[model samples]
Target: MFSKLVNPKSIAVIGASHNPAKIGYVVLKNLVSHNFKGDVYPVNPKGGEILGYRVYKNVEDLPEVDLAVITLPAELTLKVFEDTAKKAKFIIPIAGGFGETGKKGKEMEKYILEKAREHNARIVGPNTVGIYIPSTGVNTALVVPERSRFPGDGDIAFITQSGALGLLTMDSVSLYNVGFSAFINLGNRVDVNENELLEYFGKDEKSKVIIMYIESFKDGKEFMKIASQVTRKKPVVVLKAGRTSRGGKAASLHTGALGGNDAVADGAFKQVGVIRAYDEVELVDYARALAYGKPIMGDRIAVVTSAGGVGVVTTDYIESKEHGIGMKMASLDEKTKRKIKDEVVPFASVENPIDMTAQASDDDYDGVLEALQSDPNVDAILVYALFQTPLISEKLVDIITKWHRKGSKPLIVGSIGSNFTMKMAAKFEENKVPVYMSIERAVKAIKVLRIRGKYIERWENE
Candidate 1:
């Protein structure tokens, strides 16, 4: 159903414009700038040429377009949609004066949906920023290319109900070198909704993790049903807004729908094995860890750190179940302890959170991680790689990355400092090794991995 929308061979920008201020111009520019590997058709009544692509005089004059982006006013958008519906398989109307506006707007939205059904066509939104696929270079998002950055092609597929938030996230996450397979903004959700997209991405081979930011669901039961099936195959993480009555009222104003009961939603999510995130950071952090790190089969974690203070805090977070992230510190194997002791100074602590002291070198990490990986008690490893230490160089990034790729156990790294620490953390993340700036966040990521592992265990047993 989403093949045309996801990988259209031909696309038409119905309201293509020469004016840089208009969204039509930016939408067309994004497609052209990305060098989309498909035929691009630009349509406008006053068309001459836009960014070198010949603009068609009208939608009626264009050939069969797999996707049509209508960037006009609500009334004109309906007219343009009627024309494009005759030939286009999918349409994305990037106008906001729809159901969210009031009575008249809701009627207009109903008309568009009715016509869409008759033509056997699907609509992404009457109010939306649209979609972006890095692999195909198809960017329909109405954001300036220079200012709003985009992620490279990677595993996570992000779906958001809010266009601005979705774009902001894509831009922000790019700074960490976290890439995406695709981005979809389900603006207004006129025809397509989150449940359908969840199932779609679940079967998508390119999408290793599916993350969503939603305020309301079109069908709560349907979403739970889809999520249950999807989670069995690939992890699904959702950051649901509107947990309070005041928030629900705000959500209704924003999306033209009442927010579902958060208490019931929470139960449904947990029962379906859907991982829940409360904030934007947790959403991305959870998805990134699930996409790159292995599922933590057991709760035992072996923490290797250069800084003693970091190790201590990490232990506190792991040992405490206050926030439901209770994980055990791995009981170091006798041989593992011996190897760690040999690698570091005699004064170094050889316990669960092996504090190699500030004097520990990169080689010490390499040896300690290797030993921990072979330890039967260690189901996961968290490294406190403080880069400021004189002995720990940039080489530790590669050392951690190597152990991560081995896939013996899930590996997570936590580092907190200034620019130097952040730079090293970014490097580790770029290598597909999960890195968090705080010990708490890193522990939370491990908690997500454990959630995934438990789901897999339950599914297999069934």
Candidate 2:
């Protein structure tokens, strides 16, 4: 299923249009602009021409097409699918009236499914944004048509049920410079669900991490079966919606989704070793951290920082009453503590959360990081600084690069100032160190990393 969708040699766009604002036009534009290495036929009855390419009146008119993208209206979409079945083996229905709309829409969806089964055709969506494969330069997203040109190539495959949310999440995470192997928006998933994608990504050598934003699950037992197997091989992070009573009700009305009991899903996810995220922000947070951050061997976290307040906040969250993890603060040894006191100002605190004070120099920063990196008690280290301090930024980059070269443990940075922080954030990213704007985010990243490590440890023991 994935091979045909990802490696189509020829494709046809139904309901092709000339107007750039329409979804049909943007879909065609993205495919053409991204240099898709295949033949593209635009199908439209009223179309004279589009983007200098000749348009065929219908799918029957096209000579050969392996995949067909249907962008026609809901009422007329079935006819298009019937016509496309004769020529194409795969169909991506981008129209939005199926199951999401009410009773009539459900009937239409049933009809579409019957037609697809009759012709042995596979459908991607009836209400989906589409798919993107950066390596092959094939983008089928309706929103953000220009994202096809964005130089994104990484080992994470993301699948989301919400089309708009999926694209927005991609754009948001791309700001941190993380690339994706593939992005799939599975709207009103009539046939393809999270389990199939999970299995595919598990076997895909190009994918190292799998991230999903799911509103509901069709087959709970099947999802757990595949998710357990996949997480044992690679990390799987999920942001499950329809948790709250109100949200669950909204989910049912939104996509006719069956919102299962939140407690059951929670226990199921945990039993299968699936890392569940509380929100969308945490989903991406865990994705970036697990995708790039190194593994944590223990739960002893040491924080080194120039800002005392931020360090205190991070420590509070790391040991918060809400977190159930059994991580403890690893105190520095007497010798290391003594060295910090002797090498630095008398005002600096030499505790687990080392506050270097504002007067600390670049040498002081490097010294603290090196001490933490060498400390046997420290399983992971978090560094906090304001990006306006150029010396601190440069020193951080140098120290991180050096430690990374020496096989350092997970080192997380919490930067201040939105603008300057973004600049240094890119530097941390280049050095393979995850950076967070908030202390809470740093703690959450570490928490998920710890969870993944625990899961891996269990699997290895088994």
At residue 383, candidate 2 shows an lDDT of 74
Off by over 4 Å in 1: 244-261, 343-345
lDDT of 2 by residue, 93-119 (tens): 898888999999888888877777888
For model 1, residues 1-462, the per-residue Cα lDDT tens digits are 687888899999999999999998999988988879899999999878899989899988999989999989898997877778888888999999999999999999999898888898899987899999988888889887778788888899999999898888888877777889889999999898888999999999999999999998889899989999999889999999976444534565744344435777788898999999998889989998999999999989999898888888888899887853778999998988887777545667898789888879898888888888789999999988788878889999999899999859899888788888878877887898889988889999999999999989988899
Model 2 scores worst on lDDT over the 10 consecutive residues at 252-261
Alpha carbon lDDT at 319, candidate 2: 76
**Runs in model 2 lying further than 4 Å from the true structure:** 144-151, 243-261, 323-326, 338-348, 361-363
The TM-score measured for candidate 1 stands at 0.94
TM-score of every candidate: 0.94, 0.89
